[model samples]
Target: MITHPKPQELTEAVARWIEEIRPSLDPRNAFLARVAANALAAVTRELTMGEQAQAAAVERLEALLGHGGTYAALNWELCEELRAGQMDTATPGLLMALRANVLDQLAIDQPTYRHEAS
Candidate 1:
């Protein structure tokens, strides 16, 4: 039987390849290669963590909104409600949910950001 690399694994591998060759590139191309590698790393992080983050977001949304919907829909509803003052820090789980969601996003976009002092 044959095995294939997962999407995250593929992205990470490509990123590694890009890094290994980057020093041989011209300055401009090296910069672009670094950008490409960073993008790939971000994609790999997303592919690895997105599902669990999404599920946590959905669970938090349900607890906050008391209803079920797609992540987009629930997220939109949360935004709308916040904008309308239908939800706020005083609302149970609202702050925690929002914090968790944002942290999850940061984990995908820039894991180091979360580790640094804020």
Candidate 2:
């Protein structure tokens, strides 16, 4: 049997390579290399954690909306409800669910981000 690197692994490798070469690049190119490495790190985190985060978001949306649907549909419905004044900060789990969803996304997008909640 043959094995291949997973997407997360490939991204990690590339990010590492970028970092190793970054010091040799000119100032502008080095900065760009760092940005590229940071983007790859986000991709790696998404590859590793995106599915679970999405599933959890879906579950939270279903429970909050009192129905089931795809993530995109449920998300859209939630937005409509908010716009229509059907849901608000006082809604039993609205803030908590939204906070959790945002935190999960932040974990994948900017794991170093610090906020009041953090």
User: Number of the top candidate by TM-score?
Assistant: 2
Backbone clashes (count) for model 1:
0
Every model's TM-score: 0.86, 0.94
lDDT per residue as tens, model 1, 27-102: 9999999999999999999988899999998999988888999999998998999899988789888788888888
Q: In model 1, what is the error at residue 42, expressed in angstroms?
A: 1.1
Clashing pairs in 2: none
| Inter-residue clash pairs, candidate 1 | none
RMSD of each: 2.4, 1.8
| Residue-level lDDT for 111 in candidate 2 | 93
User: How far off is residue 117 in model 2, in Å?
Assistant: 1.7
Question: Candidate 2 lDDT, tens digit per residue, 7-108?
Answer: 888999999999999999999999999999999999999998999999999999999989999999999999999999998999998999999999999999
